[model samples]
Target: MATITAVVNLDLPGPTISRHVYGHFAEHLGRCIYGGFWVGEDSDVPNVRGIRRDVVDALRALGIPNLRWPGGCFADDYHWEDGIGPRDQRPRMVNSHWGDVVEDNSFGTHEFMDLCELLGADAYISGNIGSGSVREMSDWIEYLTRADDSPMATLRRANGRDEPWKVPFWGLGNEAWGCGGNLRVEQFASLARQYATYTRDHADNRVYRIAAGAHEDDYHWTETLMRSFDPLDRDDRPATPFQAVSLHYYTRTGSWAEKGKATEFSTDEWYLALSRASWMEELVARHSTVMDRYDPAKKVGLVVDEWGTWWDVEPGTNPGFLYQQNTLRDALVASVHLDAFHRHADRVVMANIAQTVNVLQAMILTDPESGALVLTPTYHVFEMNRGHHDAAALDVHLKGAPEKEVDGRTLGLVSASASTRGDSALVSLSNLDADTAHTVTLDLRGRDVVGHRARVLTAPELAAHNTASAPETVAPRDHDDVRLRDGRLEIDLPAHSYVTLELTLSPTPSQPLVPR
Candidate 1:
């Protein structure tokens, strides 16, 4: 029996948490594209323009802000021209990065943009720099975004599309230190400057170019990028033609060859996953410190374009697909990382979990063999905490909270962050203990909260997940564990649970809510 106390001040506002922080990444690996998102219009699986209707509907419900397509090492090797024109005429290529499977080029640029349009999300295109030429990259940009009658635009129109799509976010390259290009930081910076310079803005589409950033605690990489780009600034303006830098880190328990299983972990591994995921706070803090040295005004945003737990592939699944199950552990991981992002909203403008479906820590998993799709625990976390989007983060402090010892390490018993939207304040809390439920006393800084609603995502087992056989076994349910009396809120936070509390403050006089 443990009790934790926290205080939140709604008046103290931080940066508006970017909705793009909830963005999703979809790569060209495994069933992530072919079997997960697209099922062909002729198939028995209900589909919209060849994509699974259930998948599209689920993502739309999540209010997906943006989607990054065609890479995680595949983008650098992909040639956009081969994916255009007629489907039969398109050439099939070997995806050297993932499983060595042949990519039919059936779902290419057109399909990705179409999917984004359907989801009502912005498109973040990761371009090829490892094996693509400057002319090719520039032409691809023109073909998708150019409004004028250029050769690439004309070719695009001749293919089928009458109007160009709006692609606001562009990745100069992905993982240049490894898959994108095996080059030194200086060489990569040189290429980023050149390639990003040619990524033009057509019509109303202003491109926000993001430089390829460090993998983990690569402080030198961030320092080198900021230094190289520093010389490109003139009159407090960027001359390098870029607006942001990207960061990627994945949570893993063991070595790549011996990574632990996803849904078969013990309490120790569960704590380890959450503790490692919490490292995003340190990563963002240190990286933003480096970015501040060069761009103190915070003009250059830090985009965590790829992040999530990565585990060994499920049994009998293709190893290259990076497919794994999502459980309550993953929901906690999402909570910690999201809370960190909210706490660091000043510098962390956006973050995309890797990825959206049928991939590492995916939101939705689709069974191509059976036409079944189940939303994972990670999906419920996103759906429950969607209120933080576009809301001003409020100041929150936790005290009298102790740490739990697990497997030679200690982690906080609880983590919390708050945000204010109009007349309501949203508070998200995570209880990391595996056995003990904590009664949390929330001090609202004298704000009059007339009403409240809450939802909790938890299960009796730590490894509990939603399978095709039992899709609703692990989902969010209306929580009634909160009580308010004498202007103080008390919450019974179940162990290993993620809770979201929406407090309605300052209700109108004509329609006052009854206090409970």
Candidate 2:
């Protein structure tokens, strides 16, 4: 084994992990909307209001700081009022776009806001901008958040809620490039100004409006939005109206339509999927560069509100709903993406995976027939990495060779990042190679290290999964450890494994190292 030394100079500075980055997204697509979160209040399984009790508890355990609701493609055509009123009285609409299913707006604003309350999370409402009027988008803000006197507020009070939910984070639109009207950035920026104008900000309500940005690496859209922010706004106020800029990214498989196989796939396919997730680094850098040019002092941060793998659903599910299996490989992808977000925490402030449950790489999967739920392998990674939330990103340098080559492209086997909370520090690492085990040394040279314990979340196979029958097969190990000495730690990482080490530092680690 090559003994590479990762000298993390404790004297330098590191970034601060954004709590919003550790967020979950729930969209009105497939079971992600119906079977995933909403299962009717009369079901045998535990439920609070319209949301699932088990799902709420699981999300709380993951320490999800923010939750984006009613989105993805679903946000484009979604009408807020359609999902309000009495569950029985609510008019049913054809979800003509997603899987051609009937969407009874029973789980609308009140339901989503109520669910966020249960999860102890901040609500990120994606406003209707495409094919919806400025009044429609603004009315939603009034109906859900406004207090005292307002037609929407009065309707809200009649619906049985006394006080406003006071939701802080609101997304202006979903995917403007694709499902969200397919307009040029210039056109969309103008429409955003009209929609944002209506989103009422009451005296007590502090709403942060995030304008729709590009999908993936379309920095031009970001550039356009940045340039047009002044022209598109009723008020050229960068502080309140344009609180944040939103971007969407989905980790694609080797292909777009058939996202390869979710679980059963080749190593080459694994590299193909992760290689795309690894591009988050560039996405943040390029988007931040654009934002820097427009708002040089870094006023607006890139909120990657929609992100996750888009693969073929498990066998025979609704194709349009984007339901895919989550595996150990998926967990590594989540880890790498989280690491990227942490590294770029300055600019990339927030992120939310596509759908939290029963859609794409969900943390929890519900078996409605059996009234059972299984936490996916990707969920375990989220649970382990929750330590990075709101914590200061510490310096971590890796001294390891590239894992392998996929179609002439090199793959990174060892992935690592550091975060600190007061005097305690945490280090997370992942080895994506399936065949060879690695004896890696983690050198925390700058930070004054003392004693630490490691927890490993790994699997014997890269294609390992956590089914309803065997949920614990790929769960995180709370007491796993690596051999650590003064300022140095050595770990034995098996092929296709992930670990998070909790180090109790002698002093608080704050100086971020300038990456060499």
User: Of the candidates shown, which would achieve the greatest lDDT relative to the real structure?
Assistant: 1
Cα error of candidate 1 at position 208, Å = 0.5
The deviation in Å at residue 455 for candidate 2 is: 1.1
Give the per-residue lDDT digits (tens) of candidate 1, residues 405-446. Answer: 654656787999999988888999999988888888888864
- Candidate 1 lDDT score at position 280: 85
Off by over 4 Å in 2: 10-13, 231-240, 478-481, 485-487, 508-516
Model 2: what TM-score? 0.94
Best of the candidates, TM-score? 1
Cα lDDT of all candidates, in order? 0.88, 0.79
Residue pairs of candidate 2 with colliding backbone atoms: 10-446, 12-511, 12-512, 13-511, 13-512, 14-512, 83-105, 454-480
Q: Against the hidden reference, what TM-scores do the models get?
A: 0.97, 0.94
